[model samples]
Target: MPGIVPRGRRGPEVAGTGEDDSVWAEGQVRTITDLARLAGVSAGTVSRALAGNTLVNARTRERIQQLARSHGFQLNQMASNLRRQKTGVVGVAIPLGHDRRQQISDGFFMTLLGHLADELTQRGYDLMLRRVLPERDEDWLSRFSGSGMVDGLIVIGQSDQFERIEAAAAEYLPMVVWGNHQEGQRHCVVGTDNRLGGRLAAERLIAAGATRLAFFGDAEPMEFAARFAGACDVAARAGVSILACPTSLSVEPMTREIAHHLHSNAGGFDGIFAATDTIAVACLKALRDAGRAVPGHVRLVGFDDLPIASQTSPPLTTIRQDIAAGARALVDLLMRRLGGENTESLVMPPRLIARGTA
Candidate 1:
C-alpha cells in the first residue's frame, strides 16, 4: 500500500482522510521530501505552503497546496509540520530521585506536570519528558535543546548538584526551573516557598510540648535544607536544640546512624523531625524496634503526609503542601513563557497535617 488511496469521491475532499487507518494502515510514506522536490520548490517552501504558512507566495503556495491535495499529503500532520518549522513538542526536565519524594510527587512536580501537559495540549503542543541526571554535561543539554527535538523545556526538582543544573541553564535553552531561589533568580524558577513550610512545621512541633528535637534528611536538596533552616530558626527562637540527620541511602542505613546518636545521648533527645515521610517512617520503625516508645518516649513529626503516614503504628503528624497549586503555578509560568511573558519566581505556603506519630 505504498501510495494507496481509499475507494472514495475523487479530489480535495479526499486529502484529509487519505491516511485513515482502515485504508492506509499499511501504507508507506517513502519520503515526503521526494514528493516536495517534485513540485519545483525548496522542501521548506513546499512544506510552508502545505501547512498554510501565510508567509508563502500566493499563487505558488496555492499550487503547492493543490499539488499536495492531489497526492493526499495534507492527511499526515508530520508531513505538514516539517514545512512549518514547528516541532509541536515541549521538553520537561525533572530531576530524578534528587529531592524530597513527597514534594516531588505529593506536593509540586506531579501536579505541575499534569497541568503543564493539559495546557500545552490545549495550545497544540505535546509534552516530551527529559530526565536530567546529576552528572550530565552541557553537551547533553544542548543536543536535547535543539529545535527539532523540542521547542521548549521545563526543569523541575531541586538538585544538590546545582553546578550541573547551572551549566544546563546557562545554555538558555528556552528552559525554566521549578524553584526560584538563587537558581531561578539567576535563570528561571517555578516553585513554592518551602522555607515557610519548614517554619510552619517547627511551629507545630514546639506547640506540641516537644522541646528536645532532631531532624532527618536524605540529601541536601535546596528545598530540604530550607525546611531544615526554618526548623533551626524556630528551635533557636524557642531555646531548643535541633540535630540534622546525616545523609544515607535509605531508612535502614539512616536508622543505623540515628541509632548510634540516640545511644550516645540517652535523655538528651525527645522529638524527631524527618524531612520526608519515607525517612520518617523508617526512623519510626527503627525507634520502635529499639524499645523507644513513640509519643511516650520520642514524639515524631514528618513532612509530606504520604499515604502510609496514617497507616503507621501511631500514625504520623506532618505538613501538607498543595501539589495541585504548585502544578497550576508551573503551568501558568509555562503558559506565560509560551506567550512571550517574563514571570517572576513563585513559592506557595505549606500546611500542617497532624496524626499519631507526633
Candidate 2:
C-alpha cells in the first residue's frame, strides 16, 4: 500500500489500519499504548512525551507528537489525571448558612467570584463553583473535601457554620475561607477587617453630626456581626445610641424591610449604617420615599463599597473592602496550603471612601 511504512524487524505496517488489519499488521494507533508500539518506545516514555515533560528529550517528544498527530491518537486527560492523583481543579464553595436564599449572583459575591476565576485561571487551574446551605447539609464541607473532583477548596463566607468550618479545617489543610478571623481560629482565612470597617462607617456618620444610629442588615453572620460590633464600639465611646434593624439580603424582602423600618422608626434614628452597600442603596430609596433628605434629615453609610455605591444619588459614603485583593489572597493562601504549608489568615484593612451620603 502507498501508506505502508517499514518498521524494520516488526515488518511493514499500513497507516490508519483498524481492528480488521490482517494478521500481518499491528492494528491501528488510537491510544498512548498503540502510539508507543508504532514509535518503538515504552508507554511511559510516550506518556511523558505527549505531556511535554522535559524528562523526555525534545527530539523524542517531537517525534512522539508527530506520530500521535499522524495516527490521530489522543491522550485521555481524565485517565491521566487519575494516574497522577490530581484533578487540576479548585472548588469554590459559598456556604449560605445564615441566609440560604442568598444567590451566587449577589453583587458582592459575583464581584469576588469574577476576581477568583481570574486568579485561578492565571495559575493554570480550573474553578468548580458550589453554593451550599450548611444548615440543610451538615457534612457539606466533608463531602466536598473528600470528593476527588477538586484538588483544593476556597470557601466564601463563614456564615453561621463557624464551628463546622473549624472542624473541617482541623482535618483539611488545602482549604481557605473568606470571613472574619478570630484570635485562635484554625482555618486559613482571607477577608476584610469588618469590625474596623464598621468603626469607620459609624465614626463618619457621627462626624457628619448624627447622634442616633441604626445598623441595617442581618447581624447573625460572623462578618456582619463583626461590623455591627465595631459600630457599636464607636457608638458607645461617643455616647450615641445605636440600634440593629435586622434586614435580609434577599432583594424583595430587603426592599420591603427597609421601607418598613423607615415607616416604623421614622424619627428614631438620624444616622443609618448599612452592613452592605446593597442594603444602603435600598435604604436611601426608602428614605426618599419617606420624604427624608440625606444629610439634611438622615446620614447613611454602607460597607463593601461596591460599584453601585458611586452610582447612587449623592454617592454613598461607605467603607471600602478591597474585594479584589481579598480574592487574590484567598487563591494565594489556598495554593500555599496545597503545597503542605501552614499559612496564617490574612486580614486586609478597610478604607473609608467619603463620597456624599454621610
lDDT of 2 by residue, 121-187 (tens): 9999999999888778889998998998899999998888889999999988999999999999899
Measured against the true structure, the TM-scores of the candidates, in listed sequence, are 0.71, 0.90
User: How many residue pairs collide in each prediction?
Assistant: 8, 0
The prediction achieving the highest TM-score against the true structure is 2
Write the residue-wise lDDT of candidate 1 on 1-358 in tens digits: 7575663323333444432422333343223454465566787787677768988999888997787767665445564467566677878876654433343444335555777787778778888886655454444456677657676777776566466656766655366777537643455675656677677777777777778878778537777878888888899999999876664534355668767766777677687878877677887887888899887888788876756778898888888766566656666676676567766767666788888876
* Reference-based lDDT, each prediction: 0.68, 0.90
- For candidate 1, the lDDT comes to 0.68
Off by over 4 Å in 2: 1-30, 37-40, 67-74
